[model samples]
Target: MDQFLHDHPITPRTDAEKQGVVNRLKRIEGQVRGIQKMVEEDRYCVDILVQISAINAALKKVGFQVAERHVKHCVSHAVKSGEGEASIDELMEVLKRLSK
Candidate 1:
């Protein structure tokens, strides 16, 4: 896992791919700010909880997109290079945490 941290993606994301993720992240950031404002305004608890849930779902969606790309590119490259086991194990460990 430590080694994986130092490694770069075998196939780097294209500008479009990066922009898409960045766009989604920016939206999520806005949503977070909105939540902060809601708190300041003393919004209803249920309303705040709903927004929090939406944010969680949005984050999970982004996470899955990233994981899918990682598996398709990085894991595939590692398998071809005879480093599949370690790469897979590392991915699985993180995935387990993600699910939790």
Candidate 2:
């Protein structure tokens, strides 16, 4: 097995926060399964496309939530600790990728 290193958040999420994100992800998972079923049933192309668009929007919403929290907690902490430039740069790079 390969192990990958990951950074931890400066401020850990509360159980409620974790659960909220998890619930949204679970709903998205269900939506994905629904799309697969639709495909198996030969659903209309436009309807499937619409669901895909919806999934994209839902994913973006989740991403924005995580980004907002990162800015509020991580970036803010780094700024307070005099490491804002690197943090901001890292954030901007990821933001550019997200935009793409």
RMSD versus native structure for model 1 = 1.9
What is the Cα-based lDDT of residue 84 in candidate 2?
Answer: 86
Each model's C-alpha lDDT? 0.91, 0.88
Clashing pairs in 2: none
Q: TM-scores for all candidates? A: 0.93, 0.92
Displacement of the residue 26 alpha carbon in candidate 1, Å: 0.3
Tens-place lDDT per residue, model 1, 1-100, is 3365347777888999999999999999999999999999999999999999999999999999999999999888888888889989989999999999
lDDT of 1: 0.91
Which candidate's lDDT is highest? 1
- Candidate 2 structure quality by residue, lDDT tens digits, 1-100: 0111026778898999999999999999999999999999999999999999999899889999999999998889889888788888889999998887
Question: Any runs in candidate 1 off by more than 4 Å, and if so which?
Answer: 1-5
Q: What is the lDDT of residue 98 in candidate 1?
A: 92
